[model samples]
Structures are given as structure tokens and as C-alpha cells.
Target: MSYLDHCSTLLFFVQHCGARGRSIGVLWFSLPSWAELELGRAPVFWKTMNGLPPTSGESLTLFYNPAASNLAPNEEFGIAFNGGFNQPIMCGGEPRVMRIKERGEADLPIYTIKIQAPKYAVSLIFSFTNGVEWDGPYKLQFQVLKKWRNKPIIFSNEGLAEELSKEGACEGAIFPDSCDHRELRN
Candidate 1:
């Protein structure tokens, strides 16, 4: 969970979450050093986080199950994706699918998706594009954008980081601080 100790360049990343691991295929670019995190606890509340301050260039979205976490438990969460980051976000169907590039061009050059979740439970996933990872000891946070009731945004760090109190959401994690971060040789 490199949610802390960052690492990544970022060009908009997206994830489809559910009871299991990630349902929809996860597309990611190895940032220089970074990983993403939500405002609160697990089964993050996406809509609540999206409404926060908008990241400079990247678009942050949180997709989740309205009934997955601790709420309904019957209805399913929905989210979808479109490559080239040129497609519209559609939240429907279980295990929402996103178009994928051919074998050779496996790297996701661009894309976007929307995760739809219910009010009580938190189910937010985000996609970030164009970001330079940061080294922390710095203060950042996820906030519910004042404009809307459930939108969240990562402040500062250009979506790479949000402005908030360091409550230790992801300290001592494996991501940006993974042993892989130990300067390897090719």
C-alpha cells in the first residue's frame, strides 16, 4: 500500500472496487514515486471525496458500491471506463468494464471512469493524470468539496496530495515506501 511515501508520474488512473479485490481491470502507470488514498477509512466514500477541491490537471473520481460496505448489501456498486481518457464515464452493470488497448500498446495512455456509491458507506476510487510524486513529512488531506455534499478532492500535490491533517491513513505501508523503492538496477 504505497498510499504514503509516494511514487508515480500519473496520467489519470482508475479502479473498479467491490467486495473482492478490484473487479474491473486496474490500469496504472508506475509513477516516479506515489500511490493514491481516500479521505477516510476502507471502502472509501468516493462521492464525498470528489466534491473537494479539484486537482490542477488530473481528474479525481471515486466509484463505489452503494450497498457493499456496511449499508444495503444487496445492491451492487457500479463503475466503467473508456480508453484514451476520451470516453464519458458510465456507472452501470456489475464489474463495470473499460476498453483496453491491444497487446503491444498495453500501457493505458489515457482514460476515465465513474464509481457510483451510496451515502452512508464510503466507496470512492480515483483516476489521476500528469503528476510528479512527492516526498512527505508534508501535510495533505482529502476533503469533501464545499460546493457539493459528497464530492471529494485531493488538495495540493496536484491531485497527488490533498490538504488535511496527517491522521496516518497510510503510514507504514508498502507502496511508495516498498522495498522496490530501494534503488534497483536494470
Candidate 2:
């Protein structure tokens, strides 16, 4: 099989196997850096959490691409809380959804949501929407770790409000490589 075919097969396998929230072992394969980038650009049905190991009572920035689905222009992308150990998973009394806009000047409009993680929550469950359809019941579990580590935000979850103040939405995927969940441990 050609390299692109292998990449497509791997993506299909990951998409199917990754949905159930079951952790999968990472399969290592050698590929040129350019080929890896090519594979990474293919959009996948997963959400991106700006920071790693989401903690309780902190800023959580999330991105969703409406172009990935057959969403109408009138539809608003949003998140619905599935209830959690602490009941509400939002802090600072923010709304469930922020808004949708273009990250750059060109690309599919990405839906950006910002919330303060609940201080008392141990886990979170939520889903995505394009006003007409739903995407996930994605779950996140948090642990109290003594050693602190932080992953740099791969995508800029910043300046969303200002961008919304301006006109138009982006036309493509912003961070095609960032995938947040394949599994969640209960």
C-alpha cells in the first residue's frame, strides 16, 4: 500500500477505535516529517483542550470546527454539560458556549468556548453541538498530582472575544493535529 493509504487506514482505525473513550496503545511507525504533517492536517472528530491534564478551577479553552459537520450557517456551536461530580463544571458563571469565528483570516470557522473549571470537580462530561447536531459525550477525569506539569497550548485560545467583535469567521481547520481524547478512564 502507498504511504497515503496507510495514513488513511490509520486515521480510520483511530477514529473508530477512539470513539468509545478507550485508551489505545500508540503504534510507532517511521515517516518523513512532511508526510507526518500531511497526515496531521486531515480533520478528525475530536476536540482540543488548550492545555494538558485539565485541572479543577482554571481557565479551560476549547476549540471546535463547524466545517467538520454539515452545519448550517445559522447554527451555533455549543457545549452541554452532562453533569459532573461537582454538578456544574463551569466557574466564573460563564455561559455554556462562547462563540464561533475564524482563527486566521482564512479557514473554516472554529467554535471557541472558554470556561473556568469548577474548583470542586473531579471529572467532567460534555458534548459538542452545531445548533442542529451533537458531537460528543466526551469525558475528562482529573487527579490530584503532587508534581505539577503543564503542556503548552498548541492553538491560541486567546483573543476570541475580540475576533468575534470583528466580522467573519475563519475558513478552515486551525489545529488539525491536536486531538484531545481517544479514551477516558472512569
Highest lDDT, which number? 2
Candidate 1 segments whose C-alpha is farther than 4 A from its true place: 1-93, 103-143, 147-186
lDDT of 1 by residue, 51-162 (tens): 4322322233333221222222221222222111111121111222322212234321112233212111111233221122111111112222233323342221222222
Prediction-by-prediction clash tally = 47, 7
Give me the displacement of residue 131 in model 2, in angstroms: 2.7
TM-score of each: 0.20, 0.41
Report every candidate's CA lDDT: 0.24, 0.34
**RMSD to native, candidate 2:** 14.5
Expressed as tens digits, the lDDT of each residue in 61-166 for candidate 2 is: 4444435333333443343222222222322122244355444656555555443343334434444543444444444444322232132222112222223223
- Runs in model 2 with CA error above 4 Å? 1-52, 69-95, 103-106, 145-186
